[model samples]
Target: MVKTIITLLMMIILFLGGTLFGIDQASEGIIQTRGYATADVKEAVQPSRDEAGNVEVELLGKDLQQVTFEEKEQEFQEIESSNFTQKLAGSMEKGVSSFYNLMIQSVYQLVQVFF
Candidate 1:
C-alpha cells in the first residue's frame, strides 16, 4: 500500500511538472511569433532649458500624455476609499477553497481508481 501511494504521488508530480513545462513553452512560442519578445525600447526624451534656465521636459508619445499625476491620484483615492482589500481577500479565499475542493475530489478519484 505504501509503495502504491508513493508511485501515485510520483506520477501526479510528473504529470503536473510536464503540464507546467508545456504551458511555459507554448507561451514563449506565442510571444516570439507575435513579435512581443523583439519590441524595441523607445529613446528617452531629452530635457530642454527654457529662457529662465529652468529645465523643461515634454512627453514624446501619446501613451505618456494619457497618464497624468491627477489621474493616478484619483485612481489611488478610489482604491483607498473603496473596500478593495476586503473584496480581494474574499475572492482569494473563495478561489483557495474551490481549488482545495478540486484537489480533494481528484485525490479521491485517483484512490478509487487504484483500489
Candidate 2:
C-alpha cells in the first residue's frame, strides 16, 4: 500500500538523519581532543592603593569588643551549643529570612519595570 511505503520511507529518512548527526558529533568530539600543550600563566598585576584610598565602613552595632578571653570563650560555647532545638530554630529563621528577602526583591523589580 502507499501508506506502508510512505511510512518505510519516513523511517529510513529519520534513521539516516540520526546516523549522520551522531557521526557529525563523534567527528567533532575527536577533532576537539587535545594531544598535548604547555601553558604559561602570567602573574596577576596588583592594583595601586595610592590611586584610590580604601574606605572601610563598619555596621552600626558591630564594634570592637573589650571582653576577656574567658568571657569570649563562654559566649562562643553558648552560641555553638549543638542542641536540636537551636539548630532547627536557626535554620527555619534563615529560610524564612531568605524567602522574605527574595519576595521583597521580586516586588521591587516588578514595580521598577512597571513604573
Which candidate's TM-score is highest?
Answer: 1
Q: Give the TM-score of candidate 1.
A: 0.33
**Candidate 2: clashing pairs of residues:** none
Candidate 2, position 81, lDDT:
88
RMSD of each: 14.9, 20.2
The deviation in Å at residue 81 for candidate 1 is 45
- Model 2 Cα lDDT, one tens digit per residue, 49-81: 332454333333343333468998998887778
Q: What's the C-alpha lDDT at position 98 in model 2? A: 100
TM-score (C-alpha, index-matched) for candidate 2: 0.30
lDDT of 1 at 89: 100
* Candidate 1 lDDT tens digits, 2-90: 99999999999999999999999998898888675635634457556767666666555422223567989999989888987898999
Runs in model 2 with CA error above 4 Å? 1-82
- lDDT (C-alpha, whole model) for all candidates: 0.81, 0.72
TM-score of each: 0.33, 0.30
